[model samples]
Target: MKPGSLSHGSSTAWGKALRRPAALQPHLPHVRTPPTPRRAHCPPIRCGQVPKTPFEGFVARPPNSELHLGNAWSLAHACELSYLTQDEVRSIAEGRWGLKGLLCYGYGDNDGPDTQCFAAAGPDFIVVAFRGTTSITDWVRDLKVWKLPDGPLGCEAHAGFLEGVQGKWKGRSIIDSVLQGVRDLERQYGKEEGLAIYVTGHSLGGALATLAAAYMLEDPELRDKVAGHYTFGSPRVAGPRFKKRFEALAPAGRALAHRFQNREDVVSKVPAWWRAYDHVGRWWYLAGDDQVLMRNPDLWTRLRDIIDIDWDFQPDFVYDHQLRAEGTGGYIDGIEKNIVRSA
Candidate 1:
């Protein structure tokens, strides 16, 4: 089967399978159902590490002209590039991605690096990509589900994600460095030339990207410069308050932020609703069989989908979170396929 293809009748079967057992059926009013599953106890899954040469043997495809698919493919590649070493990233930025004046940050932090991001400029745009979980420390951070009450926009957010965005290196926070890079790019190319800013990442990096974009949007000078923020397999990073603030800050009629959730990508479901965490921005659900839902499915639909997941497949959670180049059931693969279909 293709990366995003589902077997026939799977959805209907899953929905039917979720019917309450006889013991817990409505007729048995005296019977109590089992407690809901606690996802907190589940061990953290490792985010995939792409091959050292991520772009090797792969040609950059012209993106479909549609806004979402075009930006999705480009931002997905930017996220893939985040995993490379600085030199390799720089070389590829200029050669493959056609980027100029690259600014790489968060490398060589032996003391303990909390985040990594890079800003690369093209003739008409700039992309800020955040690196996803790549170390034991990253996994540890991912497990830190605690919320900080005083996060960005004066709303609550995942403590670890907030730290990743606000943590300082050499007296400068990650967002600060990223903004400085953006400013430099605007000056070099002339903001009059309409240099749009795009922020993106996968998994843990996606959380940081969302937070970073939120911070940028709050800034008067940078707010209008932001074109869009895209994330893949990103877990919930903020609470309802933050979501409200983000929606207010986002431009009217323009979907400035989008979260792409691949089929059964467990990372996107984390810091569960029970923890008061909520996702920000429009959701794009990549249902198997080349179907993409622009909005989140209803609760019952989501529940049924969860019940239908193939848990028998070992490492299913991690497998769905991968960002492989293409044809490997990864985010990039899914987005590229969507791009082809849209074309």
Candidate 2:
């Protein structure tokens, strides 16, 4: 397990999907708001409750794992963009894959951040390594959640997963470091040149990205140093309360928070949404459909000039009360559910 990670975080995310009965339809139409120009607002943040948008990106994508095409594309986009701005790139590349290889993706080759014309001016590069896939040595009974170890498999590799229970994001250390990296960056470089932090992953990587965003926004003192949040294929992070808390915490909570799910993807269906965090919004893609997630109250929040993408946002889209694998579960009861606001 990566250091400072919340163990069973995936289970927590998946809990929402598992405990519910597949019933209601998903709410999406409410997000359909009359187009309006986005405006930035600075609202005071509250703890354990309401969250405010502070223009930060808390990415959970580790650098050392095997990324699917979509995730790689997202990383490439974010890395390229970060390089252009000369912002520091701190990649938590530990876990499943390994840092040494993916770390170069950010700072190596002609396409590396260092080679970019603006790279000299690019974001600082930082990499965090966790109990990645390749590193996991032991396992006992491979359950969907925690892989129980019996002998060698359970003793060595599974140890990390167990340790993760205490860490912020399942016993992974990157969680705290990711936040600290920005806090240090903010202390060193005031949000002048602009910082672009991108957190992404393939499957499990996507889940990590969500938690990282939540953990970063857990405190409001350092919201200003965030950048873009681009998750390739992620499941849900918090529950309805978590979402509510996030919405109350940040106005632009859902800004640039993109969850890219592929056609008939499996992991994408694991961390289904429930009442865990009531603040964040879920964006579902139906290929032919425009955008499955929409509720316009915070539509104006995405245009800010910050560099990071924080979780804890308000949304217009919702799945069935139960995590359903098929059909559009519980959707909008009223247009307001998709477009509610603070008067």
Candidate 3:
């Protein structure tokens, strides 16, 4: 039987369900409105009963092991925080996550419209999260698919993603600011404390996270300190050379860095493979029915999965890409459930 063939029972039940006529619908263009500012005391959109403490089960030690589901859950929330105003983010960082400080940066002021991201530090970890696509300018950046020789080892990265990380904020590039933040944390806690740095984001932000992590890992001083990078629904950011160089620098031979693709998220598949772009690190496939596959499916299986999308009666690609708060069918929902099942 062919891999992922329905008759062989190799495909998931979720894949089978998608084949039903009712599941077919024309793809709609997604337009996201700006998120309204919320009171600092209220929790962000959640899946279930809210926790008293954020990232409650996160464990930063033993960095050599495979990516932990707890860490994925925590980092997903960190990406969610990037969407909020700086003051709200600071409140969550201090009140919920117990982070000592939050430094939010808005760059591109001198060059173009601003882009925003933040770095939050605590005793055990530092999280640098880039906000995902939420504006017309952000969409323009995402569509700029040209490649440039910007990554390590002569590797080329998506020109827009490279720009996103290299653009200056107060005369310092985003990459430099991230490094300086790590340095400050190291100075405060001392290297003996083993401050683990995690870079994360969603969609366009995810591409930036991968590039930023790659840039930081290239630095000999900060390489050992960076724990990993976690991205969600992120597009491919670089070519094969970048992937090769990144593996050399990553912990556990690329196991530490993971890209989570929930169901049939269309965003993760571009800038098309034919265009010489490829993903870095490991792939965590969040299957259609909430099961998390540690590694991506084989090529044949992946192709079958794509065919299951039914272009004529397409599922909402935009909906699948969302980092939803309600907890049904989003990245956070899938990872949160996986955490419980693993326990």
Q: Which candidate number would show the highest lDDT if scored against the true structure? A: 3
lDDT of 3 by residue, 1-343 (tens): 1111123232433344222111132333332222222111211122343233556645665436367666777888888777666677788888778887677777323443346678877667778888776554566778889988766556888888888878786677867887787777767765576777888998788998888888778787778878878899999998888888887776543355788886668889899999988898777776544434436555543444445544335354545676662322567776776555444
Model 2 CA lDDT for position 200: 42
Better of 1 and 3 by TM-score: 3
Task: Tell me which of candidates 1 and 3 scores higher on lDDT.
Answer: 3
Candidate with maximal TM-score: 3
Candidate 2 on 120-230: residue-level lDDT in tens? Answer: 112332222111111112111112233223211112122222223213322334345455555554455334544444454323334444445555556565443334344
In the order shown, what is each candidate's alpha-carbon RMSD? 13.0, 16.5, 12.1
Name the weakest run of 10 consecutive residues (lDDT summed) in model 1: 38-47
Cα lDDT for residue 112, model 1? 31
Predicted structure 3: lDDT: 0.67
TM-score of 1: 0.76
lDDT of 3 at 183: 75
* Candidate 2 RMSD to the real structure: 16.5
